[model samples]
Target: MGREFIEIFEEWALDYDKSVMGEHPQYVDVFANYDAILNQVVQQSLGTVLEFGVGTGNLSNKLLNAGHNVIGIEPSEAMRNIASRKLPSMTILDGDFINYPYISVQIETIASTYAFHHLSDIEKEIAIKKFASVLPRKGRIVFGDTMFKTEADKQLEIEKALDKGFTDLADDLNREYYPTLDIMKNAFEKHHFDVSFKQMNDFVWVITADKK
Candidate 1:
């Protein structure tokens, strides 16, 4: 993970949920959709789950309540600490998905939400390979995030940010890679995953890929 990305999450840890959900109250519906999607994927297996970037334990808490054992990989200590508090029984580790150590376990599902976008395009490709390596055969990956189908589409959104005088944010958007659906599908397929997805909105998407 990049230093800047980790730092942002560290600072946002305290107010992350409130700011993210409160700033865009309409997104409450979207989060509900995310939760539902994750639930569906997790229900397919009875083994443990590994959630990448388990920010503040939102989805982790839900999974725990649902009786699935979960282990989380989070780069930000502040965010990890908060998540650990909420899910004391859960193993919330301190590393990003790209570099986290692999262990032999019966991992049935790997899930991430709104966090994978922090990685660059190449990093995402490498990370998926790591995900494939750690998971058991037929293990599934459930990912949700802001993804675009093309650079031109993402550019249009950045242009809107500039028009609103959010230059800093526009600059950030310019660097934050949102994968085209085809790109994601190809990457996962190369690693033996059968991919499928649903767009929750213009910006948010939920992808389900089962190991083949």
Candidate 2:
């Protein structure tokens, strides 16, 4: 399933940026706050940064322009190639964030956007713990992605989708375990990171976890 998603990104690479930024009504409502959310993430970040799932280098480009050294990890060759062209001097690793061998000494902060939802619920918890393992004290993990407050919150969204005749989307949301803000906070705290949540909009949020 993961490979299948990566393949989809490979095919979508050419138009990925425009597709994401375009004013599609279904997405525009949530994505409208995209830059503002990222701006908050950048404000919290410090020193050298590692970005997982750095698609097309949008956030990375912003971070670089903000004068931060950024290393990126992207799974799709096509996506990585585009990001490389956009950020010619920065190192963009070709690998999966869940399996990537992250070096604590090298990374000062880790950030991701609109990508972490690809993980299963169990995988998300494990990944956060793994991130905590490598993060130096005071290092932060900031990510903005589609998230909910609880299963009830997700169900409400699903109901709205169904009302709007997006049956397929509703079904997909049912199958995907998008984490709640509280769930993620507990996961980070379990791994000894102080965590906070900022809802960027209705469906997407930014989570910051600082290693203790």
Best by lDDT: 2
Q: Could you say which candidate leads in TM-score?
A: 2
Question: Please, what are the lDDT tens digits per residue for candidate 1 over residues 80-146?
Answer: 8999888788888778868786656778888888888888778888989988987878888888787
lDDT of 2: 0.81
Q: Over 4 Å off in model 2, which ranges?
A: 1-4, 101-105
lDDT score, residue 27, model 1? 39
TM-scores across all candidates? Answer: 0.87, 0.91
Candidate 1 worst ten-residue window by lDDT: 22-31
- Candidate 1: give the clashing pairs: none
Task: Name the regions of candidate 1 deviating beyond 4 angstroms.
Answer: 2-4, 24-46, 166-169
Q: Considering summed lDDT, which 10 consecutive residues are worst modelled in model 2? A: 22-31
Q: How close is candidate 2 to the true structure, as a TM-score?
A: 0.91
- Alpha carbon lDDT of residue 177, candidate 2? 61
